[model samples]
Target: MAKRDYYEVLGLGKDASADDIKKSYRKLARQYHPDVNKEADAESKFKEVKEAYDVLSDDGKRSTYDRFGHVDPNQGMGGGGGAQDFGGFGDIFDMFFGGGGGRRDPNAPQRGNDLQYTMTVEFKEAVFGKETEITIPRTETCDTCHGNGAKPGTKPESCSVCKGSGQQEVVQNTPFGRMVNRRACTNCSGTGRVIKEKCGTCHGAGKVKRQRKINIRIPAGVDDGAQIRMSGEGEGGLRGGPAGDLYIVIRVKSHEFFEREGDDIYCEVPLTFVQATLGDEIEIPTLTEKVKLKVPAGTQTGTYFRLKGKGVPKLRGYGQGDQHVKVTIVTPTNLTDEQKELLRQFGGLSSDTSNEQEHHESIFERMKKAFRGE
Candidate 1:
């Protein structure tokens, strides 16, 4: 079987850019992967397209491919022959797949991982805001070694395996020709250095486990599951890298009387039957203190009253939210005999069918219709 043109295999024009070639190859690879597509000959077709893309996607190899169709006369380009001697494929793999063994720069500092800590705050603390201290276990730079991982009088030495390159090259036989790839050196694990004498405290790990105390200032109106970030307070990085961030996740404890919804607070206020029949001023609980609430005369059960600016303050803006008090008129649960006789006399004086200035007719009419299946 003869080889197909690289452009034709990837379904692209001869003038297609390297990025275009990569995009085409990624789509085809996903569509024809052996794990995804179990059809016969799918693997072979995928390999053929991959090889074509691998060559034409690189600038040097594409130059050679343009000169000789599917065969680079200068560098042996034919299948099973001399076409696969190009070394630029490593760059292509690194660019496209982020693989093919690139080493981390030993001189460069890396950022550490972010850590999360759950904190419990009282309802009042969440509403009014408070500053509290919390302790977290994290990795810190070794005080004894100063993050060098070296002993008292000795220092780390360059790796002998990779000769300070931090990478090892390996040659493999491919369908086109022999290919060389770079991999991370196993001996030094790509650091390009080895610790000769271990630090006694850190044990040559360069970091020590320690508990960190961090103080966080929680803002007002913070609800449950709120997150606050403390920068550079997490685990210390390796090789003298920068420290990570610490995130405090807030969990507001349940309040005894109030429930929060956004900035508003809701609570059920109990009222006596006489207070509901006649107007009265009642004391209700607020996040800060008790406040007087007005109950209108003839107020029905489940009546809601709002007190402006009595709720939590807005976290990001000005002004406060209102508090909603739901009134529940309670009937006398346990009545004494004298109390019952007084109630019976009061009932005798009041007419059974009396409307009482039509104030109580609405509730009675609604109940009558409801019982009649209206």
Candidate 2:
């Protein structure tokens, strides 16, 4: 494929200044950097941006390119200034910020990877809290080698290729000029150490996979999707680094009778027609125990009543939330002939123009409008 014009790649005209080229390159590099952009083509676009910047950032290369226009690599264009090839994203950052982009020491402490465990809790257990134990598989530093990845009484040797720096430098004479690049050493795989004798237990990996039993406490009133973090309880760190955290993600099992919304508990209580019309004291089940709830006379269906301090405990505060009970009047079924006749007689006692009938009709109309969001 033909190479794109350097000015076009940087989204600039031929008359663009050096400062404009640098600003456009920085913006494009940051936009297409693989670390920041996860698009599949971002890496290739980043390389294109870097290549464009490499030619335009220097005056000699820009002048040569302007004269030759994508000079063939086989017949190099003469240049007075050189450009350094960046190794990775770190190099770009080091160029923007003042740093040398030196190689890191592989023996330095690196924090362990964090682990997550999803736990399903019963509705009551989540509302009232409970302590439980779970077994999870994770990586732990080797006991025999003490996280060094070497056999007992033995040690790792410094990588001869990188001389313990974990990186190797390469110099190349490009069409532009001399270019230097730093890359991880292949001999030691960037670890800066070679293990002559591997540990038999962990197989020179410095860590072992094991099933560990962890005791966890689910706090009271923790709703579904709540997370409990346990510090230093994740996979063991490398080179004596501090362990990562263990996140316990709570998934609350649904209750058969109750539903929770934030700190409040909601439940639907069925009421017989007689009990709704003529008040009665009923036993209502709560998180702790059964409590007496009085149904007022002439209570309408879908009526909501609040039971103070009968809901789930507050996860962050002192008092508990109130439980909201919605009363639903259940029409009696399979009525005997005499019972049906009694209901008919009861209905006939209330005249069409009676004030009590009009009041009930008005209440039902208001409820209908409320349900319709009027």
Candidate 3:
């Protein structure tokens, strides 16, 4: 009989990946399997599915089929047949029967988890490196069972259902041929063993939770959202696997007087109208300390002065940034009688006129004048 295309039999496209092919085949196998289904022609559909999976699952067979659509019986394994020439489709069989199907072992040891710690630092501390300690809840392997998940006195036993094979097999008859399918043992959960008695401490988890102390050293010039990684400092790994990593995220506190942008510092210094009109040498606050700043003559409001090497330190390279000082002129108010007279005399000397206050006399003022007959 003419054979159908493997991808068509599995209800898959030619672009299907290995995983996609296996998933479709498993679902169809369970549905049409003669052992599982009692419908008529169930055996034939099951056989066809197995045969298609056999060709598509095996790498060499799939390659031959892709090029020639079929493997020649004469050129097959031992020059006899294709099935004999190639190995069993362990991928699906192991998945169904709970055996070694691929390159990875699900129960094998894996690297520990990676943890993140957000560490807040002062503005100065971020500019200059600091060392500090922190306490966190972490997971560690249990000392009682040594990560075996078994009690100290008793131990785990081989699964009786699978007889230490970790899988179960079923023989089914199909139109294409007779085949065998394997699946994981339901009793042992595919581990080939059962924990008759679990550890009292971890309760079969093989791990413990405890508070841990970690000391971290922050580098200089770290900006907000900067990240630092410490190796082998994460959660405990299973089966003695390597530890994971710990990441420290730096959060910098904002300064009251100074505002930072990249490596530069910004500040606004208030100056009186007299100081702005007549320039003088004044002291201004910087990131480090107060420094003498010369106010140029005729300095206007919103004028900016740059102080070199007075800002923040560079994160990676050498040298510092400049500090920008913005000057704002403050106008005087509440003039006394003597001050007002002097100001009026000064205004007369100048050509500019003083602002006149608007008079919005109400009806009551007119009534008072009329009652006095004025």
Candidate 4:
């Protein structure tokens, strides 16, 4: 069957952004996955969406697609390039899913896989910065073989199948004409060389699994889910390639008294009914110390007070963020008879209608303006 336009397959416009293409592909992949959908054509549809995403997600390929509606210009003709000619889909799957086949380098040493370790920190530790030590299990170079797959006395030999070309070509007949397709040499797995005598320690793989302890310092004001990348701390490189990176994902534990907003801290302060009505000075807890905040007379519930420079220090700035304290008036649930008598007398003297009138006027005026489209 003929192929459909990539944009149409992805349900996207011609000018869809890169992020849009990725989002669309993720949605489609999830919906059409064989594990998720047991329909007959789910696998084929999944492959189509993956193919479309493979082209549209790339800037260079998307430009080519935009200029020439389809990537296969010579479709149905023998001269058209096949799926193997396009960029390798395995690499795309590796980038997104991080698995399938192991990526190996022929010239350089093979590097180890990157590692991720989640570290939970107290709110203060996240705000003030702290150094932490963690141990991670990773692959390292074999000590006995020294990263070479050949035995100590014997060395690797050139692959006889492809004669060190690292590739093999196969000729096939197409509609246009006979064409030759090149693929990685199976004999040497595209490495151009083969190990005659395998190493005992690494079993000819040139790597060993080991545990490594690393120290990582987290900066101040790092929010939850912040990643700290440590270069060359991951798995050992194969052959002699550079080591991969280790990412420390930060997770901040929720504080008992405070919540974070960007760099600032927020907390709710409970105020007694008498304090909210008569006004008073109260001591509030901050990250460092307690500070006194003045409560205005007739302070209502949900009133906010700002404590300057009492929040978390900015990670990349000089000044610290302010702490916002929301005042919540706590009414007495159980009152003594004498207290109830005093409250009743106070309520009788209060001008509740005056307060209601002001509130009603403000709300009605806004509603009238909104209704009139003003």
**What would the TM-score be for candidate 2 when compared with the true structure?**
0.72
**Model 4: worst 10 consecutive residues (lDDT sum):** 71-80
Full ranking by lDDT: 2, 1, 4, 3
Q: Candidate 4, residues 1-374: lDDT per residue as tens digits?
A: 88999889999998788889899999999999865675889989999999999878766556555755553432332243443242343333333345433333455555577878899999899999999888888888888887877788887788898776676666666454555555688999988789989999888878888878787889989989887888888887877777888878899999999999998999998888789878999999999998899999888666679999998889877989999999876757788999989977765666365676653454236435544556
Q: Considering lDDT, which of the candidate structures 3 and 4 is the better prediction for this target?
A: 4
For model 3, where is the 10-residue window of minimal lDDT? 78-87
Tens digit per residue, CA lDDT, model 3, 242-336 = 77888888999998878889889898888776687679899998776889999988786667899999877887799888899987766568979
**Cα-based TM-score, every candidate:** 0.67, 0.72, 0.61, 0.67
lDDT of each: 0.78, 0.82, 0.76, 0.77
Residue 356 CA displacement from its true place in model 2, Å: 9.4
lDDT of 1 by residue, 1-374 (tens): 88888788899998898789899999999888654675888889899889998778766567656864553334433465444444344443443356544334764666778899999999989999998888889989888887878897888888999887777777777764555666677988877788989999999888899988888899988889877878899888776788998878889999878999999999997788689878899999888888988888988777789999999999989999999998876667689999989877766655555577554444446435544556
Over 297-364, each residue of candidate 2 has an lDDT whose tens digit, in order, gives 98877888998999889998888998999887777899999999998777666446557756365434
RMSD of each: 12.1, 10.2, 17.6, 11.3
In model 4, state the lDDT of residue 192: 77
After TM-score superposition, what is the CA distance of residue 91 in candidate 3 from its true location, in Å?
7.2
